[model samples]
Target: MTEQQYNECVNLYSDNVYRFIVKNLRHQEDARDIVQSAFEKMWRHRESVEFDKSKSYLFTVAYNQMIDHLRKVKRINLQEDFTETTKGVQHQQTPQVKKALMEALNRLNETQRSLVMLKDYEGYNYEEIGRITGLNESQVKVYLHRARIALRNYLVSPENVI
Candidate 1:
């Protein structure tokens, strides 16, 4: 990719990559670092990166870095719901409902939640999501199906309703 292509790549995909990372991590600073690192890696390899696949490349790099970051942090806390959005800001939707769905989403394992975000939230196709998450397309489909089931079960459970 030329310098112009690289700049265009950054402009086009930076927010998307950043949002993906931030939603998974739920930590703005760490997400920012990981996103920047992904971009830097892409920058370093721009010569070999196809301009058309830059979106995939950026997302793949960002996803891997996020998994690495999670492993490194060894965070054990999962009790907190996914209540916050960008930069520690809480969602101001229907007060009771806001927490319920997020709670269900947070109940998912890391891989499952990320898959849900990539497919349902980020609008990635199975093949694209598989590339980004290092899973096969079939695996992506299965995991995503299971994740949605889990979300549905959680949301419909009487104890979880707002």
Candidate 2:
């Protein structure tokens, strides 16, 4: 990738990459750092990366960085804590349905949450998601399906409805 190509990538994919990281970490500053780090890593390896594949490369790097950050922070979200957090959100003016959806999303493990975000929010195909997530295509399909089912169950549970 030339300087021009790198600049174009920064313009085109930065928001997408940032959104992915933010969804995973829920910390804007940490998300920004991870996105910046991914771009820097891409710049360092520009000679080897094809311009066409830059987006995937950026996402892959950002995902790995997020995992490392989560491990380092030991920021495990217990079920009770997650529920309490969502209850706080629910008490605010945010729609009850949206609050429920977010609570369900929070309940997911990191891999499952990433799969849903990449597929549903980012609109990446199964193969592309596999590459970004380090999963096989079949594994991506199975896991995403399960995540969707879990989300649906959470949304439909009577106790969750306002």
Runs with alpha carbons beyond 4 Å of true place in candidate 1: 76-84, 87-93
| Regions of model 2 farther than 4 Å from truth | 78-94
Q: Where is model 1 poorest over a 10-residue stretch in terms of lDDT? A: 76-85
TM-score of 2: 0.87
TM-score of 1: 0.89
Whole-model lDDT, model 1: 0.85
User: Candidate 2: lDDT over CA atoms?
Assistant: 0.86
Report how far residue 7 has shifted in candidate 1, in Å. Answer: 1.1
User: Which one is best on lDDT?
Assistant: 2
Evaluate all candidate structures by whole-model CA lDDT and list the values in order.
0.85, 0.86
Query: Which digits, one per residue and each the tens of the lDDT, describe model 1 over residues 102-159?
Result: 7777789999999998998789999999999999999999999999999999988999
Backbone clashes per model, in order? 0, 0
Cα lDDT of model 2 by residue, 24-85, tens digit: 77776778899999999999999999999999999999999999999998885632333332
Point to the candidate with the largest TM-score: 1
RMSD of 2: 4.7
